[model samples]
Target: MKNFKEKFKLKLAENNYKFTRQREIIVETILENENWHFNAEDLFAAVKEKDSEIGMATIYRTLELLEKLDLIHILDFNDDSRVYELYLKDHHHHHLICKGCGKLVEFSDQGIDYFEKELEDKYDFSIDEHKLRFYGYCGDCRDK
Candidate 1:
């Protein structure tokens, strides 16, 4: 995770931004929790546990900077909130959300390459990335 922190610091430097203490704490917290999908409020709460002085405004600004730098991806599950995750190229997956219970299951990119290739051939367009989400009831929710 040290390398990732260094990369974030370098990105900030490249964009003429200082890697402030608050930003460092925020980034370190994010890196520590690799599988977290959280919004600004969630992040602020976690960060507050580490440092009480950090505020919501700092969280929002740091999130904006991270998104601008393409270090994180925002998942808008259409629930009136934005969730964030690290942008790891090799760690590609999609979401399966249970509407009834609000549960999230992650599925791997097993068959998407073929579909992307087909789309590229049909439309003569190059595909860069995509986000797929499936929403329905999980087994427990469905049985209920």
Candidate 2:
């Protein structure tokens, strides 16, 4: 796995974006929270825990920069709100979202590769990227 800070700096340089102290703090805060499926507000709260000077607008701006760099995935689950997750390059997975409790489970399926290949062969089209999200009641939510 690449060092998140180094990767962030490299990305910033590649895009001609300045690596500011606030951006550094934002990147570190997001990287430290591996399990967090966060929105900008969530990130702002976490950042405020360590540095009270940072503002929500700054957090949103930093998130937009990170998203443009493909360093994170921004998802809108048709709920009018967006969530973000770290983009771990090379470790691809899909989301199983619980409709009842709003929980997201990460999963991978071997059949997906076969299907993607078949689609490419049949349609003579190359698939660059795909997103799979299944929404249903999770076991815990179903039991509840």
The candidate that wins on TM-score is 2
Stretches off by above 4 angstroms in model 2 are: none
- Superposed by TM-score, candidate 1 places the C-alpha of residue 87 at a distance from the truth, in angstroms, of 1.0
Error of 2 at 17 (Å): 1.8
Against the unseen true structure, what C-alpha lDDT does each candidate score? 0.88, 0.87
Error of 1 at 101 (Å): 3.3
For every model shown, the clashing-pair count is: 0, 0
RMSD of each: 1.6, 1.5
Candidate that scores best on lDDT: 1
Q: What lDDT tens digits, residue by residue, belong to model 1 across residues 1-144?
A: 787789899999999999999999999999877466777887888999999999999999999999999899888888877888888787788899989877778889767978889999999999898888999999999999
Worst 10 residues of 1 by lDDT: 31-40
